[model samples]
Target: MNKKTQLGVPLSAQNRLFVPVLGASGGCGRSTTAGLLACFLAAVGSSVVLDTAPRLTSPWPSWPTEHGAGLASVPPGRPLTRHQAHAAASRSDGPAGKWSVLTDHQDWSHGPLDLPTDPAAWYQLAATGAWQAVVADTCHPVAHDIVAARTKGQRGLTAAWCALPFAVPVLCAPTSGTGVAALQTAVKAITAEGLPLQRMVVVLTATGEGRTPPVVKAAATMLESQVSAVLQMPFDPHIRVHGLSDADRLARQTVAVGSALVSAVLASAHHTWGDPLPPAPVPAVLSRTAVDSRSARPAHHEGVFT
Candidate 1:
């Protein structure tokens, strides 16, 4: 890959980007795509990954963390602060750059968490952190949501996020006959909702090591005309064996695909919002005294505001 290709969008306090990795169905490599996007985007600016999967199914809690509270640590009633949001996330630094991850860390034996279902809530939580880039590993059935929203004449999370000026949604599907069929259905549903199909990027992930399937090839050819870009994410042996604990171990091709995904998202954003994208809305700032008071409390008591 060219050196320029590896370079990511330059982000700063003045602007931020949100990339929501929307999966077509279960086991479609949504989390992996989100993680890779965060890793590459971190190369240019501060990045974070929000795992929106349920507590029991989420893999982020299993990753290493130091003094982190995970998503369960976020307060429900009040607005979140950048300090509090960062405190809740697990930080990691490596060849890919520095990034933080926030997800459910509650034990399986515990009851289900009251996670926010509205897309705006998730976007608000991300914006509170003042991050340069955010990759949300969304778990909702995007096609169903879009179709339901249309039926009810209400904007769903997928549509609402795509409507954002700074957001770029990625649809993930496996490279199989069934997956391709689901992807096509999802594309139609999104189109029906009147969302910008041209701004959406579709990622066809390889499930195993093998030649590209004919079904996937055909689907890609069909999707190229319907969406912004169709990307092929090759299977990585390291991910198959060890999961996404270490991004540095990903295959060269896999890393290149991640870089390309970032580029495509940036291109889409620029195309939609113009060359100089609109400045990011500044998050609320807390008083220095209040911040100090909050920091003085024990880490275990983070979510409980006095």
Candidate 2:
């Protein structure tokens, strides 16, 4: 494979690639997949994981971060500067690489966070950050979102992300009969809406250690010709016990699964947009003395937030 292909580089510096990992249903390892995807992508270029899950439910705020104001600090309606966007994100480093996470930071004692419901607003905020890749951990059920968007004339967040240019969606499901059924339904709905089914990657995640379920194996066989690729992610005990707080503790096989998923995403983008993906231009901010002082240091030397 070409180095560029392996890295999942964007086709243009101006065109940011958005990878939304949408689950067929809840408890489908959506957040785990998103975090790992961002980790691997960060190895090649600037990347961030946007926690699109609702307030109070997102796991990002609990994860360790270098520095950030949290997503709640983002001002509404005003244009977001790259500095502002970067500041609102909590940065973290691990074995895979460095990546930032933007998620709700409000405490339960406070009133509910007023997160933007308009999908365009979220996209704009991410684009303004100038991140090369964005891994969105979408919370809603995607098949239902597609139906709602089509029938009610309302734009669903997952649908909007999938429709964006340079999008490579990862649809996840558990390796169980019910999970496979939900995934099948989601694929059908995505296809019916005239979306890019060819660019979709289906991930069947194991919730616990066991042999591959017959239903999951059958689903993979049937979906092989439909989507971009079908991958099985083995269960990681660390994630089950401690959640995604520490990437370094993730099992090696789990990390390998993430690498495969990233490769599939890059291949999908290449097929959809035709590559050698153009190299991203250096950000003007890097030319400034202050930005250079902060960003020019070696990755390992950067200070970590306790």
Candidate 3:
């Protein structure tokens, strides 16, 4: 560890990737593919931070005044309703540098029991400073109390309170056979509610409208080996301009299948195992030549160690 302190710590900092965009059910588009993959990783500069897991409804851009900064909301059994406070005071007129959308906790629906028992002090205040990337349009299907409040407290500080190491659960089934018995009963209810089956993946969203390839290899053998990888999004037309337009419309949206999923999430951002793999397993319908060959390469992903 010497060489001017190992060349001033480089080697890509041992891999730093944290993209969470699961959705094989509640809208296969996963927040319009995480808002066009966070506008193609901030249009190639990369300083993204689009979090969301507390309870759901906080897509970012709603706090014009109901309570102001610190975005509030405590609605469930009653008491704590403030929710957006004018979207945290318009994130203080964001856009001076960009990348910093961390709404501590406000309730999206009941996800991870509205986690917030100190998520690494809001993930070190949202990975402070020179941000690299952080996209997180998550919520839907995998929600074991927000994966135990994101691995809570000292487990070495639970992925350093949001630095995360593995939480990619995208399984939007429906290729038939009752969507392979509801994706094998949701992988036996997340491996009998224990979690971490080598950090599962399993994707198969809207295959366009042709359903073949043995129905995507019989839903990848129904999560046989507790699923490690599988993705295939066939139906394209720029993914049907995301449910008839909410915003983006670049001639139809498939900016090269969302820029090959933001270049496979910036080539798996350093890779200490935080997010990347889970986008191949289709057949609820698709064909236009397999949606033009899954928008030409960058098909599903796979991982376990490196």
TM-score rank, highest first? 1, 2, 3
Candidate 1 accuracy as lDDT: 0.77
- Residues 51-159 of candidate 1: C-alpha lDDT, one tens digit per residue: 7778778777775434378777787744456688888888765455768898877778988778877666676677777677888888888888888877898778887
Question: Candidate 2 regions off by >4 Å?
Answer: 1-15, 153-155, 278-306
* Candidate 1 steric clashes: 0
C-alpha lDDT score of every prediction, in listed order: 0.77, 0.77, 0.41
Across 1-306, the per-residue lDDT of candidate 2 in tens digits comes to 543445554345565667989899878999888988888887566789988777678877887457589877776543346777888899877665778999877777877666766555566667668787888888889888889888888766777888765789999999998999899998998888887888999899999998998878988999999999999999999989877788877899988888898888888887887776544333222223333355432221121110
- Candidate closer to the true structure by lDDT (higher is better), 1 or 3: 1
| Better structure of 1 and 3 per TM-score | 1
Q: Which candidate ranks first by TM-score, i.e. highest? A: 1
lDDT of 3 by residue, 27-98 (tens): 455655555555545443333444455534544443211222332431221211113222332221111122
Question: Would you give me the overall lDDT of model 2?
Answer: 0.77
Cα lDDT over the full model 3: 0.41
